[model samples]
Target: MFSLYVFHLTPIQTKNPYPTKELDFYSILWSVLFVKLLIYFLAFITY
Candidate 1:
């Protein structure tokens, strides 16, 4: 299961052939995480 997960994740984490799309996927993933963290921080401050 873990290996399967890593296999699915490898394209985004590594740049072997399809770099552009994978990089875009990574950027979108990071952006979502950043937005979630920002929202959590703001909520904590307000609370």
Candidate 2:
């Protein structure tokens, strides 16, 4: 799932990279947190 997130962002990150490295780093962090939250939500719903 983590690899999937990285794979999904690669193209968009390459094509329209963030203006600042700090913002880019934050975006990646946020995306990872979001993905983890989403996974937990889905698992909770199903379990």
Candidate 3:
């Protein structure tokens, strides 16, 4: 079961063949959202 999961994830883990500007914008947006979530979680922990 674990090997099967790894096999499925392998292709998704590969780098993009041709990343465009749109991809970069989306990635930046995703990173911002991730940071926001992390901060929220940390605040919740401290409060």
Candidate 4:
């Protein structure tokens, strides 16, 4: 599921022509944290 979500973002990220490396790095970091929280939420719901 996590891989699928990241895979989905790949095209969108590439499509953005702006080459702000730092901003992209930060956004990716935030996305990883968001994914972790989402996974935790889903696990809690399942439990």
Candidate 2, residues 1-47: lDDT per residue as tens digits?
66766786676667665566855776688697877888898999999
Residue-level lDDT tens digits of model 3 in 1-47:
33554464445446554356755665566567666877887899999
Give the range where candidate 3 is weakest over 10 consecutive residues by summed lDDT: 4-13
Best by TM-score: 1
lDDT string, candidate 4, 1-47, tens digits: 66766775676577775567955875687688878989898999999
| Each prediction's whole-model lDDT (CA) | 0.67, 0.74, 0.60, 0.75
| Model 3 misplaced stretches (Cα beyond 4 Å) | 1-19
lDDT of 2: 0.74
lDDT ranking, best first: 4, 2, 1, 3
Task: List pairs with backbone clashes in candidate 2.
Answer: none
Which regions of candidate 2 are displaced past 4 Å?
Answer: 1-19
TM-score of each: 0.61, 0.59, 0.60, 0.56
Q: What C-alpha lDDT, on a 0 to 100 scale, does residue 34 get in candidate 1? A: 64
What TM-score does candidate 2 reach?
0.59
**lDDT, model 4:** 0.75
The Cα error of candidate 1 at residue 33, in Å, is 0.3
